[model samples]
Every structure is written in C-alpha cells, then in structure tokens.
Target chain A: MLVAGEHVLFHRARGFGRDTHGASPPTVLRHSLVKRKFFRLKLQRERTFAPVRTLYNLNLRQSGKMSEKIVLYYFDGRGKMESIRWLLAAAGVQFEEVLLTKREQYVKLLNDQALMFEQVPLVEMDGLQLVQSKAIMNYIAEKYKLSGKDLKERAMIDMYTEGLNDLMEMRMILPFKKPDEKQAHIGVIQGKATSRYFPVYEKALNNSQYLVGNQFSRADVHLMEATLMLEELFPTILSTFPNLKAFQGKMRSLPTISKFLQPGSQRKPQPDDVYVKTVMEVLNIQIP
Target chain B: MLVAGEHVLFHRARGFGRDTHGASPPTVLRHSLVKRKFFRLKLQRERTFAPVRTLYNLNLRQSGKMSEKIVLYYFDGRGKMESIRWLLAAAGVQFEEVLLTKREQYVKLLNDQALMFEQVPLVEMDGLQLVQSKAIMNYIAEKYKLSGKDLKERAMIDMYTEGLNDLMEMRMILPFKKPDEKQAHIGVIQGKATSRYFPVYEKALNNSQYLVGNQFSRADVHLMEATLMLEELFPTILSTFPNLKAFQGKMRSLPTISKFLQPGSQRKPQPDDVYVKTVMEVLNIQIP
Candidate 1:
C-alpha cells in the first residue's frame, strides 16, 4: 500500500513493516490478493480539501507493510483515553501519542475552529481528525477485524462495551468533593456498584473465557481497561470475584497486551493515582 | 417464505403481507428471485429450539408483503427505548411491544439467567434475544439499510451518534448536587458546555441536510432524538441555530419519521415530564 509516497505493508500476526522506495516505488500488487493472504491494507493517498478525509488506498509493497500515520492527542492522564491507547496496542496499529499538558495548548485546541469538539484523545488518522473515544475504538475494531466473528457477536460486544462505559460513569465523583467525601465516594463505588457489577462479569467469564466469544475481542480489551481502572482506584476490588480476576490475568497475559503493558515497553504511563502507577509499572507501562 | 405453515411476503414500501394457506401452502419460489425485484424478504424456515423464531417463507402473496414476528421489550417510558421504537417504525418491521411495568416482572427478568445483563429494552428477534439500545438500533439499521450507503458512511454515522451520546451524558445531573446546586449545575451545562459544543453541530447541519450524508441515516435519527430531548429540557435552545431548526423540521417531515411522530399513529408517548410532553405534542408525538 502506498501512503504519502511511502510503501507500507500490514502483516496479520506481525506489526506494520515499511519498505520505503522513495519516488520509484515497487509495482503494487492487487489489494484483493494481498487481502486474501495477509492483512487488510488501507492506503490513503487523497489530498482532499475537507477538514477530515479518511480515505485509504490498498495496493502492495515489495518488502514489509506500514500503516498510515496515527497520532493520538490527549491530556497527560489515563482517564478517558487509556482504552483507546490499549486498543491501538491490541490491534498492533502503530501510533504516536502526543500527551498535551500545558494550559496554553488546551486553550489553543479549545479555540481552534477546525477541531469539531476541541476534545482529546483526538485521533489524527488518514488525514481525518476523529473525535469521540468509542467512535475511534469502533473504527479501529472494524479496520483490524477485532469487532467480532459475526454481526450478533459484534452487537453483543457493543453491549458489553457500553456496559463497561456505564460502570465507569457510575464511579465518577464531583470535582468539589472534599478529601473525606472522596474517600466515601470511592467506598460507595467499590462497595456497592463494583460489587453489583463484578459478579455479572464473573458469571459471564465463567461461561466463556472471553467476554463476548471464545476469542479476544474489542469488548474484552475495553473490559480489561475498565477493570484495571477500578483496580487502580480501589485496590482489592476484584479479589472477591475470582472469575473476573482470572479474566484480567488471562487478558493481560496476551502477547500484544502484555507487551504493551510491560514496564519496559514503549507505553508511557500518563498521570494517575499511586495504584494505577503501580499497575502500570507491573504491566511495563512507563510511569512518567 | 415459509414461516410455520404461513407464507409471508415482506414488501419494501408497504409492510408485511400474510397469505396463510393452511396445510397446503402455496408453491414456494427461491428467495433470491423475490429479493432481486419485489422485496428483501428474509426467510427463516428452521423449526429451531428457541421460544421466539423470526421466520419467513415467501410464496405468492397477492397484495403487499409481510415480515417475521419481532418482540420489543422495554419499559413504558421513552428514556432509551424511543429511538429503538422509532427505528422499528421507520423500518416498517412488524413488532409486538411487551412493556413491563411491574417490579415483580423486573425481578423475574433480572433473575432470568437467559438475559446477559438482566436489563430491559431486550429485543427478541431472529432466534436471538438482543439487548442494549444502541446495539439493537444498529442491528435494525443494518436490517433496514438505515446504517449508511457504505462502510465509511457507516463509520461517520457512528461518530455522529456517539457525539450525540456525549452531549446527552454532559446534560446528566450529578447525584450529589444539592437542590440549590442543581439550578447552578443546569446553568453550567446549558451555558458553558452547550455553548461550546452546539456550534459544531450547527456547522455540520449547515453543510448538509442530514448529519452524516444527504440521505437520512441512523445518525440523523439519533441526532433528531437527542435534539428533541434538549429542546424539551431547555425550551428555545435551538433558536440560535436556524440550520439545526430547519434540519429538525426536515427530519420530522420525513414520511416514516412523521408517521412515527404523528399523534393518532400507533406510537404512544412514554412517561416523561411536562416539558417533554409539550415538545412531543408539537412534534405530533402523542402524550399518553
């Protein structure tokens, strides 16, 4: 696939490979043949005038394959953007993370008329600035075939993903909450809500190794991120649900996921609590 | 198509048509021929084990076609189920609504191990009991080709739908807010958040008649629902955006949408406040 004058190849089991041939690129093969054998090579070559144009061209490269440039813009926190980061890693999609922390940059991004929502975890991919985390996640899932085995499976995955989102929403606290209130809030989330939700997950995991199906899907990935989050915020929360604990262990042990989570690996940890930092360190996500 | 002993024909423009020819059913033609010209008739002949089996066997139905049986389970309220109801109505898919109001039924459903999440808004169709409003909506969208023209268009639709969902989440009231603080809370949401977010939508509407594309897609349907909710909650909110107002009028004016919104139509308004009641009445949605 020729993208931005660069020859890129996407291997199924392996990550992206680049075969830069400068101006005189190698003769591209029919994308159909490549797709049948290797991966779904998406090539974006159009220079459209629209602010967002996510067009991809699929040809071939003689050597290895490379993906289009993906830059993830987010704050220096593992809040809403962590799942997206994890999704990129799980999909083996090569991306550069731009951790924006400065107040000036926030003001600039907010004032920027081009940005639809002026929000982050904004994914700049294939010349389109994609907003909304779930949208980005769904896009990656489709592109990588991480959605599900079938339509019903995909819908079930969506259900589980939305459930995880709801669980996260239940844990939120007001910014004006006093230190004591914060403790009480966490207690409420961990004791009541988490206790109620985790068992359902435990029951599901007991039935199948994964959340949706036999294979690891985007739902499992999302569940993993949310689970880690809960664990970080309230340690020993998952200890009661043995199946959920097992599920977490199984998910983290995946080669791609483990590699991303590994302390020495490339995934740099954003601003989080002590527990999250510890989890990151154990998982090999660098604590910045 | 042969569903049970009855031959059902599903017409595109018109709803289902039933030609129940007792034991000696009419000569069944191959489904492919019916699909090419007359209608996209889905036939399920399998006498499967499931309690609900959505099956259709097509023969010569003289008048308009008929579809398989669909059961929609939700509360009497329109909270999350209204969009699903709208989609079903728009698709012209014949469905039976099982609105559960009793706490005993709720407990029974919760205990029913068949339910994945033990949640309402469960759609029993095609031998599968589907849950989650968005998931069900997507399923119906795909079934009716309301998703989009293609994959990219579908992704765009997903983006806009998620965008609308984000807006809804932003409008939610924090549980901990005091009675006095609630007014201030609404003020911040309406003032700072709505001001910052709504212009992007206005701009998008100005660019196109619908949210995703020229044609009315699922995204437009979702956006319409959310826009109405906002309008109901905060009267005169859309006065600033003429394009959006026009878009709402245009969407509400659509045949299927207008039919769904009509007061005398089959749709009965779910439990909501006086504000929502007024908006529904103006939109021709019955305030039941």
Candidate 2:
C-alpha cells in the first residue's frame, strides 16, 4: 500500500497486521492466504509508487511547512561561504543564513557528531544535506538554474571553479604559518598568479566580457568573490595583471554585488591584513 | 537526433539550449556558446562512433592499437594512472597500455602546447581524448554499468573517489621535495588516514565484502589502487589498517583482476622509465 507521503512496500506473504483492520480469517491457513494476497497487492502498489514517493513527500512538506526550506550553516566571514551565498542570492532563492562565530564556534561545529566533512558551509535543502562548499554551490546553482545555460558553459564553469578551488587551497597555507614562511609562500603564489593564472583568465575574458560568456553565471559569482579576496588581501601582489583588476572592477559594479560592498557592509579578513601586520613587525613600520 | 549508445542532447532555440534528447545536463554552465556547442556534438558523436573511430583513427595511427580497444597513456611504475588501469581491468575491459618515456618524453608531454595539467594516464576511449584520470575512470565505470545500481550507491562511490583523490594530491607532493620533508608529510597523512580515513572506510565496509553493494564496482577498483599505492609506495605506512589491507587482498582475488596479475601479463614502460627512475630515487625507493 502506498501512503500519502511514503511508499509502503510489503514483501511476499507479508501484509499489514490484521489486528488493526478488525478483520480475521476463519482459520490460520485462510488468514495466511489472505495476508499473502494482500502482500502481493501491496507489493504491486509499491512498484507503482516507488518512483514518485520522495518527490511527492517533498512537495507536501514544502507546501505545508512555513519553516525555512533551505538553511546554509556557515560562518559570516567569506572564506568558503561567500561564493555559495552569492550563488543563492543570484538564484533569487529564499534561504536562511545560519552564521557561526569564526574561531571557537566554527571549530565546535566541525566537531559536531552529525557533521559530515568537519567543515562549513553545510547546506541543507528540502531534507538533503550537502557538505563541500563547491558541491553545495553547484547544487544550489543547479536547483535555481543560475549555472550556465548550456553544456559548454557548465564545463567551462566547472573548469574555472575547479581552478579557483586549486588556487584557494594553495592560498590557505599562508594564514596558518610563520611570517617568513608565509611571505615566501605568498611570493611564489603571487608570481604564479601574475605569470600563469592571470594570462589564462585574460585570454578567457578577452573575447567575452565574463569568464565563460557574455552573461554572468555562478562562475562569475565565484570569480567575483576570489578576485575581491585577492584585491583586498594581496593588492600589490597581483597588480601586474591589469586585465584581472579590470575584471574585478567590472564584477563589483554589478548592482547585485555593489549593494553588498556599500560603506559599512561587513568585510571578511584578508590574508593581506595578516601579512601586513607580520611584515610591519618585521620591518619596523610604525603605528603612527 | 538521439543515437544508440549515445546520450545525445540538442538545445532548442529557447535562447538557453533545452536538451530535446534524454541526456541529463549538469546543473551549471560556465562555457562560451561556441565551446558549448562543439563539446555537445562531440560527446554525442563519440558515444555513437567510438568503436569505429578508435579502430581507424587512434589504433591505426598508433603501433599498439591492436592490443586493446581502450589505450591508457601511463608511465612504467605506479602513479595516478594505476587506479584507472586497475578499474578498466577489474571491469573486464580490454585496453592497450601506452607507457611514455619518463624524463624526456614525460617532460615533453607536459610542455606540449595542447596539454592541460601537464600530466598523463590520459585514457583514449575509442579515440576520444579523456584527461583527468578520475573523470576517465568515471566515464568507463558509468559506461560499463560498474559504478552503482542506485543514486545513493553512486554518491557513496563518488565520496570514496573524492577522498582517495584528496589523499593522492597530498601523496604526490612527496616526490617533488627533500626526503626529510617527504617523510614528515607522509607522517601527517598517515596519522590522518589512521585517525580519520581508515575509520570511515571500516565503517563503510561494515562486514560487507564490497564497498557499495554485493557486487564489485569502481569503488573497489579505486580502493584496490589506493591500497596498492600506499603499500608499495609508502610501505609500513598502511600496516596499521589491517582491514584495509584485507580488503585490497580480497579485491585482488577477484578472477578478472587475478588473471591480469598472473605471471608474464604485466605491462612495461615505453621510453619514460628514466623519469620514473629519477622520481623513485628522489623518494628513496628501489624499482622492483
């Protein structure tokens, strides 16, 4: 038998208990036979019900519940969640932003018993839970149709997203290390970004205004966040790439993003701030 | 416009291409229209004409085309390609092994004008070029119906594949640096695997003989390759994970795989042995 919000499958010779129905067969064998018949019928019903059960349940729950349909559990700082939140906003979807304190509260969340990746931003949508920031962003882009409109666009978006992810992973080592080591690492990355990555981005953006195409996409949103981080965190480092700077400016000018950058809007900590503090101490830059 | 053995899709004139065929498009787009159209048609045609194209184009063009319909461009010893080759063989798929020369040839390939990522184990499936070993392995697994039967099972397979990839990226750093540094890095990874990864794997196995369901899938192939690499490349590192070792041994015992490992059937290097030799020496490992 198929329930309203669930598919109930009964195995062969197994049926709903007879006690609840107030019906009993004349004898044990007769009862068993009746149960077997019901079991077969219920199995048939389940086979028909299996495909649409979950979809139906989700629809029902979404329609009935006034609670937030999507909740993104993350820290307020940009680090990982910036691109995802941007993507969700771009999609025009309504979602709850559950912010956590960066240092202690965030670590506690990672240690939570039910958390999958020991990280954030974790996105819960319609009951499905997704970890991995990139995966979550992609899922939201997918659900809301904010990803590119064609196959090539999606692949290109994927390529750029993966590339940015690689860059982010490399950049992450900067903040959690010693001063000298951090400077050396940043120098290597800055050199590479100028000579290697910037060229790729420049060429990618040359014929088209955006990274993938003329219209903006999740890839653009991701690039926007990454470029914003780079500009605020390592301004002088990537100054050699004029095209990249211009691209960053163009992204920031978008009305959707410009509002977010208004004066007094919260700004995330950039590695550059940390670098500056350490370097000033090393080189004796006075505090005025 | 749909073709057999092909997941063909045509974007309608709806500005955003709507797939008229039954192909499932990914949720995001990030490519220009020109590139998007090219890949869509190419992927569609490749599926339909792969066998024919391989016989005439790739196989006839290369000397060893007669050996295997699937040619995996790899190195002499173990690296990223091992898992891919293992997956193909485990799936009972016949493939030609094209080993490149290590120092001169491998470096040349990396510096190839057309190459992306400067790496190998590029799988030539029926003449279509597939880079990224994980993507290639996935293509093969999906085509052969060896990934998983259901959505949940497929997601689990993806989880394991992604986890192994994360570990592999860390392990790759070992060959590019000093021995002490390499050992320290290996120690960190080993600790994490013991404390984090191994437990996850153990729970997934949970007394089951296979990773996904009753039958062997690409997850098993990946597990086999990862375990073998850990044991052979970083001996004593995986000794603590007895269950993982047992699982590898169990995978090796499969008839399809066991046949490949039988005496004299092992493949060799073409001209890339020198680079492999240098890398091995740098890592302080003797070639068997």
Candidate 3:
C-alpha cells in the first residue's frame, strides 16, 4: 500500500494466478532481466534490515500462489505519483495500475480496507504501503537503479529532487486556485522566482548540465515534470527565466522524454489548465 | 552555519576553558537534527532507500566539528527557531542566539554569504551550517537521544512533528504581514483556524496524549509553541475548540513550563507577542 496526502492504494491477493475481484493479491513469477536488475537495485539501496525483511516476508506470504511483481495504486493527476509512473515506465517494469476515478469510490475503498491516504498514486509492494511522493519516487528509482551510482552524486539527486518538489509546491500547487486569485498568487510566485528560485536554479545549471550529476536521475525526472507543467500551466511566469526555459527544452529533448512527446501520449488539459493558459497569455508566449 | 528560509545561525568555538568570541574560524552546517530525523523517518515509513548512505554521510559532517556547539540565527518571536531552542534546552546543550532585526540586514547577510534563504532560525554546529527547522530540530534530538528510543515511537514523533510544523507554517507564518494588512489577514486566518486546522488537532488529540510517545519529545515542544501562539496570536479562532484549549492548559501546567510562566522568564507579553495577544483577545481566555 502507498499513501500520499489523502490518497491511499493497497494490493491484496485474490488467489494464485487470477486477478481478484476485490483486491489484487501478490503473485510469484519469474521476472524479466530488467525486473531482476530492478529487484537487485532495490536490495542494494535499502540499508535497514527490518523493513527490508518485512517486505521479503510479505513476498513470501504469496510465494506459491503466482508470479512475483510490483503493483501500484494511484490517482491520475494528484501529488507525486506521475513521477513514479514515469520512473517505472522508463525502467520498463510491468505492474498493475489501479486508478480511483471518483471521490466516493475512493472513500468506499478506504472504508472497506485500510488505505494509506483518502486519495491515489500509492504503490503497494509486498504488503507495505508507502506514502509521500518523494519517498515513492526515490523508492522506485532505487529499485530501478535509476538514481546515480556514487554516494555524492546520489546526495545531489536527493537534493535536486527535493528542491524540485519544493519549487512545485510553492509555484504550482498552492497557487493553483481560481483564475483571478491564481493570477495574483502567480505574481507573488513570479517575484520570488525572479528574485530567489530562478537564480538558484540558474546558478545550479551553470555549474552542471544536469541538476545533480552527469547522467539523468530522478531529479531530472522531477525537474522535467515541473518544467513541462510550466510549459502548459504557467507560461508567462516561465518566460522570465530564459535559463529555466532552456533547461526544460534540454530535458524534453532527451531520448526517453522525447518518446513521451508523441502526440497520442500527451494528456488532455484539465480545467486547472486555465492557470497555465493565463500565465502564457500574460507572457504572450505560445505552448509548443 | 545552518540556513532555513531567510535565517542563519553559526556555532563557533571559544578558547579552551574560557568561553570567548574571536577564538576560531566558523564552519557552515546544513540541515539540522530535526530535518535529518524527519527525512529518516520518512524513509523508514516508506521502507525505501535511494542511496541511504549518501544521506547518512551528508548528515555525518555535522558530527566532526571540534570547538563550536550550536548557534541559531532567526527572527525574534517563536517562529522557526523555537523547536531548535527547545531541543537544545531539553538536551542541556549550549547555543548562541542571534536575531535578524531587519529585512535589509537579512538580505545583506545572504548576499555576503550566499545563504540559501535570507531568513532566520539557522543553526551552526562545529563550523557547519544546517538549514530547515524540522531538520535542525531532529538533528539535535537525535544527537542528544531526545527524539525517541525505539524506531516506531520515533516515526510517530516525526509524524506529529511534521503535522505541527505544517500547522505553524499555515497559521503563524503565512498570514503574518505588515501592520496595515494585519486586521483583514487576521480574519482570514481565524476562518481557516475554525474551519480547517482546529478540527484536525482535536481529532488527533482525542487518540494520543502526546503527539507520539509518553515522553515529552520534540513533537511536544513544537506543539506547545504552536498552540501557545494560537492562544496568544489568534484567540478568537481558538475559542470554538475547547479540547484544544484544555490541551494548551495541560501543557502550560507542566512543572517545567510553569517555571517559564513566572515573572522573569520572558514569557511576559511584549509588542511583538502577536501570537499571545491575538489568542488572548480572540478567545477571551487567560493563561495561569
């Protein structure tokens, strides 16, 4: 199970091989070479013995029933689940995806069984539920060996990932309200961006091509997500920071991210997209 | 040196045997005990580690300082530095408290040092600067063994501490403004208190005595400072929440706290006692 904010996702076994009607149960099956490598990566990153053992025990409980694999419970567009989804997809890991569409359905599921958050984007591995977007993203990244190899580089990844998260929370999440109020809020955010945040990122980018290390890591993924949102969501504010714009361009040009840019892969804009639209309108910029 | 937001503090060494200034060069510190413990607690709760050793090593630099102890830099009033101060006091640790009185001074310091935030409540220990209040608090708590003895209890401490910090940021920090906007903002904060935050605390308090364990951990200190502020700063909103009132009373009645309440401890009301005055005026209640 995984919980972030008010969202919770859980995985339980139906039987051995079949997908259960109520809750999906764990399965024991042979993994692909990539999956095997992912599992080794997870083991290597986990330092504590207790929780690792607990996860192992959970897998053992369903060992004889079916094949072993990972499962995810998530909401489509809330919190930090999107990055986790991207990480899993990038790593080529196949897992069950359960999307909770309605709030009522979400609450009912919570009442029937234990849910981490009252909301989605939770990953249930073995029996344990993980919450918090950073935690989930880092976990999946570790499991996939997507984080940088060395210790210092890894710290940089954590730092940049966290920095991106903080930036999004301040820039996008909190200010994402009605149109007029959002505009006012964005003005404040823009001021800070010009004065504080953008300069920091500009300095960071000047120091290295990537936020953290030589190769792309979860930090890059998070930055890509934030910058991509700005491309659609807050274009006007985004225009002030040309370096940030270039950074976004660089990230989207990456092979893996470039694949995601195919026409069909783009998600339809939500009602909240108006905020982004307004930002662009204010900035007089067009979305790509 | 540690930086959280706009605050910075430094821990510097005096001569051996005699405590005096200008004896040695100061080192900068990043992330406090509270922040580290919070991160660790999040990692533990998630049962995931992405380069755990990297985080551990980043944290380890705080331990090797030779001469200095902890020094806090922040604004006056129990804003960000309260928890760190309380943690040090609880652990019987020594620290220097430096208050940044003006915004210009803060910006000057930041420009001079390239500090992360031109803010307050930063701690410096053994020449390193640590930022983020939760990080600082947890670091001190861990070093002194004040957080918790067991893992589960420690996690609970983190949960409550994080919640309280969220509350403080929402209540105390965001709404505060120049005197001209104070009245209107007070009403907004009052509405939020009555409509949102109060109920959450009431529900949480119904189940747990302390935020986490039986012992008075840093969570309690954080809760105490926040609740105390609400009582003083936004009394009108607090009036509806009797359980919260009783909780504040319970905390204030503790022997250690009672001593601080006596005449000379600086608990007396001052012009800057926005938290205290607001709560008192709104709730029409007095602390014994």
Model 2, A1-288: lDDT tens per residue? 100000111111111110111011112213333454453344321111211221112234345552346765544445456566667665555566554422223323333322343334566674555665544665576666655776545555665665464455445434433443456445544543454345567667776778876678777777666666666557675566667777778877777677666664333455455443442232122232
lDDT of 3 by residue, A169-284 (tens): 44433322334344644554444445545565666677567776677777767767767655555567566666777777887777767666567542323324544343223222
Q: How far out, in Å, is residue A284 in model 3?
A: 35
Question: For candidate 2, lDDT tens digit of each residue in B144-204?
Answer: 7776786556655665665565454444434432343446445645644554455667677
- What tens digits encode model 1's per-residue C-alpha lDDT throughout B177-264? 2344446445544552255456767877876887777687877777777677677668888889788789889887788878877786
True lDDT of residue A287, candidate 1 = 16
DockQ, structure candidate 2:
0.04
Q: What's the true lDDT of residue B173 in model 2?
A: 34
TM-scores for every candidate against the unseen true structure? 0.65, 0.58, 0.53
- Model 3: how far residue B147 lies from native, Å: 6.9
* B-chain TM-score for every candidate: 0.64, 0.64, 0.58
Local distance difference test, each candidate: 0.52, 0.48, 0.45
What is the DockQ for all candidates, taken in turn?
0.11, 0.04, 0.04
User: Of the pair 1 and 3, which is ahead by DockQ?
Assistant: 1
* lDDT head-to-head 1 vs 3, winner: 1
